[model samples]
Target: MSEKPISKGKRSVVITGASRGIGRALAHLHAAHGFDVLAVARNFKDFPHHPNITCLPLDLTWSDAIPKIIGCLNATARPFERLINNAGIQVELDLTRDVGDETPALIDREIALNLTLPIHLSHAMVPLMARPGGTIVNVTSLTSRQPKSSAPVYSATKAGLASFTSALRHQLAPLGIRVVEAVPPLVDTDMTLGRGSGKLSAEAMAQAIYDGIAAQRRIIAPGLSRPVLLLNRLLPELVAKILAKS
Candidate 1:
């Protein structure tokens, strides 16, 4: 492991989109693992009330989201040990201008939530991250390695994040922070509902992610991600054809 092992205890973990799916599972998993979890989500009505979990209700797409997050951290008077940029949106829009009924607003929102927000959050959280053992986990997708025609914008954003994660890893290495790019296969979540079959459960994916972080891996590609990525490298066109249909 190139990164230092994270010390166990009540260190804070900030997770975006923690109301459901992978983020929610991660919040609970970390809390169970002895980390103080700060769950950030717009909806908190169904949030799991745990002693180690604190809910922060705010739209991550808002203009002042970063400031509000920073303010919250400052109020806690504690540097977070981990920041998981897990909030993202996927919109199926036809880019063809003539027959397409796509809204520009939706496209902007998707990009903002998926790509732009993570970049800004990573930068803002640097100072607030615990030194020497701080870790940043950026959740990307297999669609990142290959573009998906159905969710073209989502593909683009994840691809952008993947590149950013690599560069950030190098940049933060000297600063004693570890940046991890976590790639999960299609999971059984609201996002993928009715779209894919044989999806991995969010709980399982969360466990894989936690294990990856514990192992201090720079790139945590879980489930089919490892094989898909290897195949993509050897046969880009074939993989692209398969993922485009996914």
Candidate 2:
């Protein structure tokens, strides 16, 4: 990815789940490019950041804090031109016919964190994106297209974002607010440590992500993720079998 050009004219950017993984990489990349970064996460204090980065300790899962946090971001001279909604969880929701549970607790939790929180954040940020060059980069997963048996709810949430990315691209295009999906393959993060194979380094994934954003590629995937997406399109059932084996 081309180094985020200083000409991009970004004064500030907001990235969630910035304690580690891809979120942290993007934060550093933005800081290096002279963009003030607002990093939000549960353990944000643990992450070291550049002078330009402001760490906001926020639990996005706490539904009530959304408006207040967004207000703080908006009360600035320059609102965020880039918004990366990467705060999501990989939850295990094993709902089966024989299962006896009072409620679909796992499914509800996944929807809240993985889907609802991001949606709420985006809704709050849309008004701040009054400028002509705003961007929204959602860090989704490869499992959106290759859902396996172990984490159906996780995949479903990502798949929803994938679809939202497409529709949002059209909706926001006229307004100049580009919505892109950073669909990563297995990366060397705690989220995918035991779940993925042939993982790419976080730095490499970060580079690809920024490149895709600068170039405005709607679906961003590094390493072999693009090929895998293509293969799944051509041979979905075959790809399912392979993913099931994994």
Candidate 3:
């Protein structure tokens, strides 16, 4: 669906998964900077109330909800300066194990949230984005660079998003929209509770993303993700062996 032209006024940002973790941090950062924020999440009972923030409670997994989201944005008449696609889910079940009844449903949900939603939202917002300074940030993961054994579907979805972001970047460059890929390592969010060590805090990761966007970095790899990416590039086999052991 095409969004109507937004009126020129206060810069606005739309962030998915804004109820917690990195998404919450990004919403606060933008709001603090005086930008109006459209924070989309399933629940906002604990979200900080802010004058510049509008909470939109919605489930992103429902493909039919995309049009309603865009319609809401159009009705707001706020010029879009940024769109952060940060909502995602990971099922940590090993595919080789005894399959459960819910495995297929979980896989579909993961793919929809991690990959399809972002692509659809971006497509809908491209025409409404600010011509000269708009930005779209896709929050990918280190797993995209090197897949994990337990969450193969999550890893594949992230890798697909990375590629989509790359292509979208080139396609949108002529119109001056910046497409940014944010690759973060294990983060200390509820999503990764008790999963990995040496994880970066959500606040720290958000700061890195903000700084990287300000600097117009095409790819933002914060904390351990940076070294992990470099190692994967320089010594593929060594990285593969290490990941295999993990």
Give model 1's clash tally.
Answer: 0
Residue-level lDDT of model 1, residues 46-140, one tens digit each, is 77577778788889989999998887777674667999999988888678742444477778889999999999999999998888889999999
lDDT of each: 0.86, 0.78, 0.87
Better structure of 1 and 2 per TM-score: 1
Query: Which 10 consecutive positions of candidate 2 have the poorest summed lDDT?
Result: 1-10
Kindly report which residue pairs in candidate 3 clash with one another.
none
lDDT of 3: 0.87
- Residue pairs whose backbone atoms clash in candidate 2: 1-211
lDDT string for model 3 (129-167, tens) is 988899999999878888877889999999999999999
User: Listing every candidate in turn, what is its Cα RMSD in Å to the true structure after a full C-alpha superposition?
Assistant: 5.1, 4.5, 3.4
Clash pairs for candidate 1: none
Looking at model 3, which ten-residue stretch has the lowest summed lDDT? 1-10
lDDT by residue for model 2 over 1-246, one digit each (tens)?
A: 111212233587888888799889888988888887877778864576477777777777776658756766755545468888887788665676526574376677777878887777877887777457889888888788878677888898988888887887888889888999998877898787676568898778888988988897888988888988899999999988887887
Estimated TM-score for each candidate = 0.93, 0.89, 0.93
